[model samples]
Target chain A: MTVKVQREDFDVGAELAAMTRGKTSIGGVTLFVGLVRDMAGGESVSAMTLEHYPGMTEKQLEAIEAEARARWPLDDALIIHRYGRLEPGDQIVLVATASAHREAAFESCHFLIDWLKTKAPFWKLEATPEGERWVEAKDSDDAAAARWANQDGDQKG
Target chain B: MKVLYFAWLRTKIGVAAETVDLPPEVKDVGGLVEWLKTRSPKHAEALANSKVVKVAVNQEHVPYDHPLSPGDEVALFPPVTGG
Candidate 1:
């Protein structure tokens, strides 16, 4: 498993190749990449700045990655989140999970992103036509994370 | 103790971090926040709504009733919105 918080962009192809280089047992890989949008809340967004709590951010991410591993029989997992100024269509984050079966890989990937949305300590501020505004936390995001709570029976190989 | 703020809380407070000597009565995160609000108007404005402001002690998320120590590191910020 790996977690990376950086300002530089990542190459999806290279990262995937490196992850599965010698892992012949892996049968499936699921990944998700978040991107900056040009429009938000009905306003035209020119740019976005991602702010994070540095030390605490890494610790929380590692904790959640560990949680994902405990609940899923997975071969590998990865989380890459970016920070700082970004324009529309810029990559913000990436989550990937690998397992012997497609079900485990797919479910774990969904769980990681759901948990990351609410538990991670990063914030986004968008520069709009009027001015910059901080993105508000959505209740829907919290609900998405909450659905996985108490789902102990969902754990599978 | 050291206190840190992030995002809008930092912007509203006009500072990112500060070192403060806690009062004897401040024994928990909630108490520390109440005391901090008394420090300045900006602090009061930033922390006016404690429900929206989340707190962490020593880089770990904790309840408002979580106990505090003299040398602890405290951070206050809003709910996370990342993916």
Candidate 2:
């Protein structure tokens, strides 16, 4: 597993290739890319500044990835999150997973992204015409993470 | 102790960072918040609704009962909204 927080842009194609390298057993690769949306929660977002607890952010992401690996037969996983100022059309995050079968790769990839959205430490300050405001946490994110909780499974420490 | 504020909490508090000496009895984040409330009316008002304020110790998300030390760094912010 690999987790990174950087200011430079990442190429999804390169990252996917890197994770799949030397893995002939892998039959499927799944990925999720999140971009800055122009609007959210009825507010128009012109730009966003992403802030995070520098040290803890990567730790939390590693924990989330470990949990995903424990629950699935994934061969490898990669997470890349960008910080600092970002405007619409800029990529915010990418989650990629590889596995022997499509099912495990797809499910675990989705799980990793969902869990990161809620559990990760990154915060966004949205620049709106009304004024700059912090984006509110969505109930959907909580609900997404809650689905994994119902399994009565332990998260990998 | 150095206190940092982020996200909406920074906006509401009107400052990004500050330094203050915490009382000895304030053993944890919860206690420190209570003491901060008495420092100024704005602090009291900003933290009045604890649901909106998330606390961190040394750049880690910590529980309210997390302990504090003299030189420890503490941060306060709103819940995350990143994807």
What Cα-based lDDT does every candidate model obtain? 0.92, 0.86
List the per-model TM-score of the A chain. Answer: 0.96, 0.94
lDDT of 2: 0.86
- Per-model fnat list: 0.88, 0.78
Measured against the true structure, the TM-scores of the candidates, in listed sequence, are 0.97, 0.89
**Candidate 1, DockQ score (0 to 1):** 0.88
Error of 2 at A129 (Å): 2.5
Error of 1 at A66 (Å): 0.4
Q: Give TM-scores of the second chain, every candidate.
A: 0.98, 0.93
Runs off by more than 4 Å, candidate 1: A153-157
Which residue pairs in candidate 1 collide? none
lDDT of 1 by residue, B9-72 (tens): 9999999999999989999999999999999999999999998899999898888999999989
Model 1 superposed RMSD (Cα): 2.5
- Candidate 1 whole-model C-alpha lDDT, 0 to 1: 0.92
The parts of candidate 2 lying over 4 Å away from their true place are A153-157, B69-71
